[model samples]
Target: MKLLLTAISGLLMGLTTAPFSASYLAWIALIPLWLFTISHKTTSLTPGVKNKLKIRNIIVNEKTLIAFIWGFAYHGFSLFWITGIHPMTWMGVPWLFSLLIAIFCWLFITIWGAILVTLWSVIFRLFIGSKEIGNSPLPPLTKGGEEQGMGIKKKTWLNNNLFQSISRVVFGVAVWCLLELLWNQGDLWWTSLSYTQSPNNLTILQLTKLSGYSTVTAAIVAINGIFAESIFVLGVNKKQFSLLILTGTLGIILLHLGGFYLYKQPLINDLSKEINVGIIQGNIPNTIKLYASGWRKAIEGYTNGYEKLSNQKVDLIITPETALPFDVEYIIKNSSFYSAILKQKVPVILGAFGSEKRSYTNSLFMMTETGNILSRFDKVKLVPLGEYIPFEDILGKIINRLSPLDSRLIAGTSDQIFETPFGQAITGICYESAFSEHFRRQANAGGQFILTASNNAHYSEIMPAQHHAQDVIRAIETDRWMARATNTGYSAIVNPKGDTLWISEMNTYQLHQGTIYPRNSQTLYVKWGDWLTIILTILSGILWIIDN
Candidate 1:
């Protein structure tokens, strides 16, 4: 019954976080869902038909079940979003194969690591001696009746249930928020090191480095997990509880809805002109490149679509990353193709390759109406294993044996704001959209509008569309209008406040046209950029030390 309950809780948690843009409740949904696992742990003891029961057995079972459920929840829910990705889209394959691949990806994610750390930490705290609980090579308690250890001292200790419960709730929330924010910052680092099919390059060292960072990141997450679990079990109905939920919900909502309102307010709407930008949604299949006959058809599809939209005379014609697979130089040299850009009149921003020496970059180029390459920004953050392989010499044979044609591409430096005839725009290509720092930098570096191009088709409808929401968040964070162009769908014109002024549907070939404002300024997040997260992380660390 207990195991069944634990598993059911796992399934519920999984379902809740699976769909993209499901609800803000998903973030805190784990709180109540995890309670079932906690409940099973406390009831596992057969108390000889009575007697307040053996607390020891309860603690032990709690530790074991807690560990199992933590792993199950993190891997199950956080990675549940993976099914929406293309790599795992081969649903026709053997069930075991699909399951194994999804599990493999989740196991490596930093969130899963944090779950493990939290469960173990809790177990150690409950049953282990004070010295062991502190996990430091020092005395457990001092003359002051406070626990003391290496770089740690207990300022607060609970002898009663109420105090412990209150402490637990506060600890849990602080931990979750701290870990969430830290994970936010660490995501760029992790993506830089890990392998993905989209960016297409990562070496053995880079993969190994991902594991290393994931371990450290998980440890921090685990610390936060302890707080989360404690609160789930005992921290309900407190004054702080309402505040936690309110703040958390508001943060999540603002993340999705706030982008539009903040950007379109008196600053952008009343002052700036709503420029119509045309986004060409080129729905190119992943397998198109493999067939010789598909090349002409694919090229024609994009070119024809662009030609159709060109007639509209929009302010900017934007397309997804690698809308044209070839290098930018090749496109410019071709008079026929260059004319396509020039005839549009307004500046054109699209994803393409930029070659320098032996290295080829995943880049975005801003072209003038007269066929001039106004400015170009190379993608600094490359997806590991997808774009390029890391540690090729050593892990080459192994990686090749597992995943063939796995290679590495060179990364670009400098997040350059393209100065065009219309205005200067902050542009992020593909995976660059996920990193908040990149957008903040571009905005701070005198970018008037945020222009992002992405090829999310590799993840199919779920991830790409959900991931595209990052643009909305980016717009809100920087208080700038975000114009997003995705290869398949979810293209949108987002205001500085993080609201979607206009958005394209998912999984289709369409040319989305909308007039978007250029904010020409900055927000608190844009200026300071993750300073709040840093302060929270530092405070959490300080609290952890003090608690120990």
Candidate 2:
């Protein structure tokens, strides 16, 4: 029954994410599971029954199975759309076999996320379920058949219950954020609570300007922990519960109010250049994007698209990742393609695959009006299994049993900044926008703008919108205006504050021309990446240590 409730809570949490976007539910979604973690009420041992009463507290440091089950439901609901990348899509395999492989990949992601959640649960359980914590000033909790109110004569101990509850909440937020940072080390760091709260809630989103998303995530999780503790003590604390209720209730209100104040502060200055940019949403379908027969039509589409955009006389024109589907050198050697870029005498930034002696890189570069390659920024962060699969020697055999090609691509060096006609711009290819630090590094290095090229053709409808929202978070964190060029529509221009200045419709080919304002002042997050979040996380750990 407990496991069932935990799974339900997980689904409720997933619903607050994309495709549903009922983000208001995130505040209350985790309360059920959190309460389950701390529930250890002792039933009355009246004369009616003695040994039949079963306690409900979770064991110390081994909260794996329930945590895994809960996380499985949560991540499975949120990431089910990833099945679109099954071997059948690009491999042309059997339908039934492809469906099974997709399901297997989806299940692998669910299990991987479940393990991280389980680690958090185990560490939190270890702290709150220890015997050394009894000497603390907090009230003596019931333990080993000890009465709750028997040894709580001291006033210092009376407040232990309050401190313990808050400490439990702190422990949860700290450990959860710890794992969040860990996964961000480049393996399945997709759905942090901070990323989930984008464009929908600007007040919470403002927190990103001062401190990166990790701080906002910690604040939200801590609030969930408080709510869980309050709900668990609902009927039992009727006598002296007013103070506890006030503290918990006021804590939530104050947190949001503080966030709102920060959001409304005069944070960004409008001192930078106003860029007149045009982006092409090529709307290329993945079915034949790489096919030999479709090469003529693909080249014609981009050439004609550039002609239409050149008429607008925009300062910079952008194209999605791999807009040039063929080999870049071969395509550039053709005078017909170079004529389209050279005719307008304007700079164009487009995505293409480049090769350097047997090694290929997913790269973005500046194409000058004279048909010269100005500067190139190869993709620093590569997607796993999608762009380049890991352990290809072992997993490649199983993957290529159905698919055709399974090879590794080369990774670019750390220092990359593309100097374009419109100032120095930091370029992020595909999922690289999801990592906030990628932008921060370039922003600190004097890159004034962000240009991200993504191929959203591979995923479902929900994916483009989700990807757009993540980019909005990046603009807020770095205080830099950003432009997104996607292959399959939903190209957009976003301001420093994450407002969508101009957005193209999905699944439709169009050129978006708009005026976007950049920022000269660096945000606190851009100046010092994740420093505030790291400090608070360490403070939470110290609180956990003091209580234990």
Candidate 3:
């Protein structure tokens, strides 16, 4: 029964983002998990000072396993879109064989992601989730409340519970933040829960301005913690119901106030220079995009999109990842599109393959209006397996031979920034936009605006929206206007305030023109990065230890 509740909570939490995008569901997503723990059997409260909590440490192993179950269900559902890769079978392998490989890949990632949830749950249960906080009267632990509790006014646990509850919530958020930061350094950063809030609850997404995603995540965990604590006391004191409502309202208000205040700061008229960009969505079919025979059609798709956008007087034209099908240089030197783009006298930003020292790099290039190379940004964050296989030196020999996957591209450094005529333009090829730290480095080094190019043709109907949702967080973190160009939809322009100024549709060819202003000032997150969030989490952990 507990397992089912946890799984359901995980599923509901996923619905708050991506294809469904039911943001309100996040508010009550974790209630089931909390209810299970709070309503379970436990030890009686002891009134004496210095008395131990008598917490059987109940549900020790069960909670951790339940957490795994919840995480498995959550990630499995959230990432099932990856099975879209199974179409590789059409590349040459047997259909059943490709489907099995895709299934293996999906399960592998789901299990690995579940570990982050497991770690968080275990630490919460082991450290902050102590039954004392689950059911402790604060008087004995409350400073100077020791005398009053002896007179039987001992229900003051609410006050005491507040401290523990807040600490646990902070701790819970820290665990998530820590895992996300770790993933940012790896290949899985795209799965962070911070992206789950979209369209609606961004009203409170303001905490992101002060402390990056940590504030938003902590606030979310805090809500669940408060709900659980309130449930524990609902029968003990009907008054907790009112207090919980008040506390929840105030917390939500503080978040909104902070977010709205900072969100407005970027709106003031300033001296920042602006550059107009024409974002093109070609909506190319995924079937033949990467093969040799279909390359021309893909290139022509962009050529047609350029013709539509060129006359708008846009300063530059941007295309989705690898929209050129191969490198643009080949087409420019050998094709008519070069003269067509030159006729417009505007630079072009598009994804193409670049070769370096006999190795290929998934790269984004800026071509000058006169058809000269402006700047090149080799994709620093490469997708594992999709671009290059990990442990290629050792396992590549074995896996490459057996699989139809291509494993040759190299990774660029985090310091790679493209110098545009206006200012530094940070380019996040595909999903690299999901990593806040990688994007911030370029912004800190004078990246005025962000350009994220993605190709979502490998997934089903839902992926493009989910991918775009992730970009919104990057804009909020750095206070930089973001330009998202994608293949197969949702190419958009997002302001530093986290507003989607405009977005295109799925499988539709469209052209969007927006102006981006370069930002000179930096948000607290862009300046110090995740260091402050990490420090606060450590401090919160220490406080939990001291309070316990």
Candidate 4:
């Protein structure tokens, strides 16, 4: 029954994130897990207690098991879309083997993501001590107040002790934020609690301008903790429940109010400098892109898109990642693509393979109106298993069969910024948008706008939508206008306020032209990076230690 409750809570939490996007569910999603953890006390050894080690082992094992169950459920539901990688016959793998690989990837990522939540539960238990905070002993009755039945005190645990409840919530939120930060450094990070409010809850989402998405994530966790604590004390103490409810309510109001204020503030003092940009979504299929037989369709789709957008005389035209699959020299020598670009007399920011010293890189190139290369930014983060195989020396023989490429692509340095005709452009290839710090650094380096090129032809609708949401958060965090161009759908334009000004349909060849301003101002998140999150984690850890 306890495991069932934990699983339900995990599912609720997962539903609050992308695809489902039930943001309100996040407020109470953790209640079931919190209730179970708060009621299950770890047995302590008294002076004459027998088999203390045995009892302790039993308690520890149970906690770990329950935590694992909850974590697995949460990540499994959230990342179920990973199974879209199946049917790898397009990549020359057998149907049975492709199904096996897809299932393996789904399980592997789910289990790997679950590890952080499991650690969060274990560490939270350690700080909570033998006696649960919800089950802490009541103090003596107030003066002139009568004792309740069975020697129970008339006064509640929170009559004059609100600090205890507040401290616990703060500590829990801090721990969660820290764990998310730790997990985000790894390869499998996709969903964060803050993203639950994105593109819908604009007020609270504005808080990312202060300290990146961690601030909003901290707010979400803190509110959930308060409600969970309140639920625990509801039957035991009505007054405490009221107080907690009020406190949680006020916290929500103040957070939204603060974010609203930030949202209303002007991002740029002068909006006079703007660039007309055209985004192209070439609905190319994965099979066509991989095989030599269908390369013409891929080229023509982008070529037509460029010609159409250039006819409109936009300041710049952008294409999806690897729109031209071949390297720079190959495209220049063997194709009329560059000549057409020069004839158009318009600058284009296109994606193609780049080579330096015979080493290949997935890169974005900014071509001048004169058909000269302006600047290029190679992808810093490569997709694992798809682009590069990790631990190749050990798993190379087996996993290499699943990989599309014969050799791994080299990673580029993060400092490479595209010097465009408009301004310094911050760019990401495909997967780098998930990392907030990467964009933050670019914004700090005087990047006025962001251009993210992606190839989402390999996945379903869910992955592309989730990818688009990540870019929205990145725009708000860095206070920059962002334009995303993808291979097969969800190409969008987002303002600094996290608003999706324009978005395209899936599996469609479309062209969208919008005006985006290039601003030099930086947000606090871009300036300080994740320092605030780190400090909050440290302070919260210290508070938990002192409280225990």
Candidate 5:
């Protein structure tokens, strides 16, 4: 029964994120898990046997297992679209083997992501010690010096101290954000708690300018903790229960009010300039892109989109990742694609392969109107197993069969900016958008706008929408306009306010033109990346020490 409740809680939490977009569910998603922890901690044991057995350690292990189950369910449901990579016959794998590989990848990543939540639960149980002091019965006083009820004297350890209650909420929220921060620095990161409110909870998302998405994440976790506390105190302490309800209510009201004020503030200044940008979505399939026989079709799809957008005389044209599907030297020497780009009057920012010595890189290139190479930014965060295999020395023989790429691409330096004709811009190739700090550094380095190029053709429909939501969060965090161009669908233009001004359909060849402004101002998040998270982590440690 406890495991069932934990799984349900995890599923509800997953629904709060994109493709599901049930943001309201986040407020109560943690209640069941908290209740389980409370009940497990307060369970009665044989009076004499409790001390003989290692009950504390046993209960801690049980709580950790429950938390792991919850996390597994949450990530598995949220990232179910990972199985869309199956049917690798397009890349020359057997049907059964391709299906098995896709399933294995899904389970491996789900378990990897679940580790953070498991650690969070363990630390929370250790520090918070879910004893529910408010609900415990108070001993009766007698005329004698000692109390009569339990043979203990009256002491100051009263029920439902406001300070203790507030500390628990704060510590829980801090631990959650700190774990998210640490996990994001690693190789795999998909959805953060902040994304649960994205594109829908616009007012709440505006707070991200103060600190990164951790602000929103804190808000979510804090509210859930308050409600969980209220549930635990119901019918036990009326004053504390009422106070908890009022605190949760007032917190929500004030958060939205403050967020609205921030959202209404002007983002553009007199020096802000607008550039007419054209985004191209070439719906090229993986089968055609990998084989030599279909290179012409791939070339035609992108080149035709380029010519069409250039005819509109936009200031700049952008293409999806690997739009050319060939290295720079090969294109310049053997293909007409380079000549086609040279003939265009407008400058083009296109995605293609870059070669350095014998190493290849997935890179974005900015070209001058006269067809000269202006600047290049290689992809920094490569997708695990998709872009390159990890632990190749140990697992290379077996895992290399799962990758679709012919060769591994090298990672570029972090925080690199591209100097464009309009202004300096930052680029996050496909998977890089998931890391907020990656873009925060470039924004701090004087990047006025963002350009993210992606190829979403490999996954199902759900992945593109989730990818789009991540870009929305990035735009709000850095206070910059974003131009997202993708190979299959959901290419969009997002403003600093997290609004999707324009979007395209999936599996379609489309051309979209929108005006994006380049601003000189920076948000607090851009200036001090993850500073709030660091402070919260320190505070949490201090609180743990004090509580212990």
Candidate 6:
């Protein structure tokens, strides 16, 4: 029964976090789960029926054990989306090997949960001490709150927990800030660094400059979470807790909606009609995409999508990054149909592969209705293993033979915004969306909207999508509307304030259309970048020192 209750509660909690009206209520529901341990106590049986009482105690113990089981089960289910990619990744492997990998993932997740609980235990203890502003009542270790019942140093234990929680939060924030500082270096954008191998490789590390602001942003988020924890522990009444959680979540969600709403209302001036945008999803296998033949299938899938949208009246069409498979310059310059589609006068923005004989770049191209190239935006950041391996030459000889993946896809040298008739659009390909500074630079540089082209088919839709939703915080960071087009799921629109206006189902091919406001402008995140995170980290550090 306890297990059942825990499972049901967990499922409810997960469902409430979905993109729905009830999501704001998850914090309220979470409290009961946390509070359960507070009241957990064993009961003594009557002397008249000692044996019967033993049976009753056994039942209670069973119930308690089941409850713990249910809690873990619920946690696993709530996080099942994290595991979705394992099955997909294991498709071509031998059955036994795939099974082992799948089991390993589940095992890792279970261990992760154990670690999270241990961390929460420490943090929860800290929250208790600071909850009511000073020394307060805590659960007695034994019956009747008797001093002789448990003689261990209670204050010492409590203080230790508080110290550990504060230390973890402080350390986590500091590490994040340092990483951000390292990535951005001196310039907010367009900072260059020398490479070990290619002195003339002249690599342009703009994503960290443009999008590397996440380190600071994440620190600010941690501060807010800490504040929320304080409120949960110290707030006067249940109503206060409910209202605070509700208000905070609602305010953030509204903030997201308001940005897009405000942008569209003013820029369009009531004249903007809803535009149909077709997104193409090519479910290409990650393992095969590195090989020579990978490009052909990817191109074939995109060409079919292009032809399907050709006869339609789409004002704009989008394709995931590198959806073009083979080099775009080769096909667009040589292929007849590629030129013919653009002649129809509908502008298209599609992910393509491009090279200048000396170097290759993962890029997005903008074409006029007549299929002529108007502009191009190369991906600023490269995926670590999927795109190219770092320190390849030394490691490549060993890794190349062991793993049949490519190690030579190179990075780009610029953060150029695409000039579209609607306005200037900035591209954050894949992981670029996680970095706030990159989007800030784009907005500061007169970008109208953020268009993120991603290929999430490699991972399951849950984590990637949830990870993608974290970008709403980025939209909140920059106050610029964003539209994400992903291959194999989660193509959606986000308002400038950070609300997901609409999103598609995972692992399915679909086209979604929506109205977005585009304007050359800036927001708090654009101007200040990661000052909030720095400030919060400093504050947390100061408090930790004082508390210790």
TM-score of every prediction relative to native: 0.68, 0.89, 0.88, 0.93, 0.93, 0.58
**Highest lDDT among the candidates is held by which one?**
5
Better of 1 and 4 by lDDT: 4
Model 1: lDDT equals 0.53
* Tens-digit per-residue lDDT, 1-548, candidate 6: 54466566655544533232144333343333333322222233446756555554544444344434434554455455544434333335565554454554455454444333334333333322222322133445767667654555565544643454344445444543444455544211110110100111111111112223343234233443433434544533343345445655664455435433543443222236344566666667665665556666766666666667756776677888776655786777765448557556668787877774566777888887777788888776664433654457864553342223222456665567787667788678876664555667777888877778887776654555544554555555565667778777678787654456787777675666666667545555576665644775576667656665
Q: lDDT tens string, model 3, 453-496?
A: 99888788777777877788878888878899988888899887
Local lDDT at 18 for model 5: 80
Q: How close is candidate 4 to the true structure, as a TM-score?
A: 0.93
RMSD of each: 10.7, 5.6, 4.7, 3.1, 3.3, 12.8
Regions of candidate 2 where Cα sits further than 4 Å from its true position: 41-62, 87-90, 131-154, 238-241, 265-272, 401-407
Better of 1 and 5 by lDDT: 5
Winner of 2 and 4 under lDDT: 4
What digit string (tens of lDDT, one per residue) describes model 2 on residues 1-548?
Answer: 87888898888878877657777777777776676555544222346553323112333322456777778887888788788775465557677777777787788777888877777776665556543222233344665745634554544454666677777777788788778878777646567777667767666777787767887788778777776776655554542246556665786678678768866666444545677888988887777777764466568778887888788888778889888765578778873656888777777886877886686788887988777888998888876666666677986666554322233466788788788866788778888877878888888888888899998776787777778878888888887788989988678888777778788887788888877555567878888887765776788778867864
Give candidate 6's total backbone clashes: 12
Question: Of the pair 5 and 6, which is ahead by lDDT?
Answer: 5
lDDT tens digits, residue span 311-421, model 4: 998999999999888888788777666877978989999898899665789999999999889999999888776777678787567755554555457889878878999
Residue 504 lDDT in candidate 1: 78
Residue 421, candidate 3: alpha-carbon lDDT: 72
Error of 4 at 437 (Å): 0.4
The lDDT-based order of candidates, best leading, equals: 5, 4, 2, 3, 6, 1
Model 6 lDDT at residue 95? 54
lDDT of 5 by residue, 300-349 (tens): 87778778888888889999999888887787777766777778767988
